[model samples]
Each structure stands twice: as structure tokens, then as C-alpha cells.
Target: MPISHIEHYNLRAERSMLETLRDFYVTVVGLQVGYRPLSSYGYWLYAGERALLHLSEARPGDPREPHLRSTFDHVAFACTDLPACEAHLRNHGIDYRYAEVPATGQRQLFFSDPAGNGIELNFAATPDS
Candidate 1:
């Protein structure tokens, strides 16, 4: 069978960063904190009913050190209300960059999460964006 859409992306962070990461995704990225059921310390981030991101707590001297230090170039989600999104970013004092697609008119907001994972909020082409 052909591959379908991306199910989710998982990230492991220092145990202390778990809550901060959850808040960042909820506040800055606009995802809802949802039930994980997988682990007491795990988080499942949802965009509506679709679970798009999973977070795991890192152990002491977790062997996955190298991967966690890598910056996420970005995780993108189709979005709406460019102005509102921009306002939210500013209101939260988060650093970000925005641009428009010259041909398609799709607008993009680029920023980093609290854990330094890059995030992109994409708004579809509209008469006014």
C-alpha cells in the first residue's frame, strides 16, 4: 500500500523539560494537551482529534543525547487566521519570522519551541492574509 500522511513525530527531552515542552506546544504552537495513556510522564499533543506529536521523558544519561540536541528544522501544520496567530506569538513574547509564498500566497510563521524545536504555522492562500 502507498504511504499515508505523517502520523506523528516523537521527541524525547530531559525529564525536567517535559512540562515546559507541553506548555510551549499548547500555548505557542496551539496544540491541545491530551491524554497519553502510554506513560505517566508522556504527553500526546493533538490538533483536533489527530495526535501529531508525542513527548517522552528522558532518563539520566539517556543514550539518545545526540538526537535531542539537534534542532528541529520545523514541524508544520496547516493553519488559519494569520493575524491572530501573529498576535498570539507577540503576546507570548516568542520570537518568530513570517513570509508569504510569492506564487501560492500561502503564509508561513516560523519560530522555535521552548526546547529549540523549530515550528512553522502555515495558513492557506486567502484573498487577504
Candidate 2:
């Protein structure tokens, strides 16, 4: 079958960083912490009813470095309330870059989580935005 859409992305890190990243996604990114059916020690972050991101505890000696450049560039989410989202980022002292698509006029906010995973928040073109 042909691909439809992304189901979710998992971020594996140390427990401390995993918790911190969870809080960042919840508070700053506005995703909700949701139920995970599996027995693994981790969290499922939801955008509405769908879990868009998963956070898992890293195994011992797992050398996945967040800061180091990787082939994966970023993960993007279709979002709304651009102003409020920007305010949340600023209030948390998180740095982000803002842009607007020339063709569609969609507004976008770009930033990274504590684990250095790039995140893009997109707001559809609107008069209020």
C-alpha cells in the first residue's frame, strides 16, 4: 500500500532528559501526555486524539547524541494559534525562528526540544495569524 501520513516519531534518551523533553513538549509545544499501552518505560504525547510523539528511556551506553548532526532534519506538525505558541516559546526562554510561506502564506515556528530534536509548528494562512 502507498504511504498516507506519519503516525508518530519516537525520541529515545536518558530518563532525566526524557522527562524534561516530555515537559517541554507538553508545556511549550502544547502536546498532551497520553496513555501508552505497552509495558515499556516511556510516554506517548498526543496532538488531539492521536499520539504524535513517543518518548522512551534510553538503553545503557546508547550513544545517540542530540546535538550532533544527523540525516534526519526535523519533524513538523500542523498547528494553530501561532501567537500563543510563540508566546509560550518566549515565556519558556526557548529560541525559535519564525517564517511565512510565500505561496500559501502559512506561518511557521521552528525550534528544537531539549534533546535537540528539531520541531516545526505550522499555522495555516489566516487573517488572525
Q: Count the backbone clashes (under 3 Å) in each candidate.
A: 0, 0
CA deviation > 4 Å runs, candidate 1:
63-72
For candidate 2, what is the TM-score?
0.93
Candidate 1 clashing pairs? none
Best by lDDT: 2
TM, every model: 0.88, 0.93
Q: Candidate 1, after superposition: displacement of residue 32 in Å?
A: 1.0
For residues 1-129, could you state the per-residue lDDT of candidate 1 as single tens digits?
899789899978876677788888988888998878784577999999989999888877784343245535778889988889899899999888988888998989998877677788899998754
**Model 2: how far residue 116 lies from native, Å:** 1.0
Q: Per-residue lDDT tens digits of candidate 2, residues 30-71?
A: 899999998989999998899999999888888566677888
Model 2: residues >4 Å from true position, as ranges? 127-129
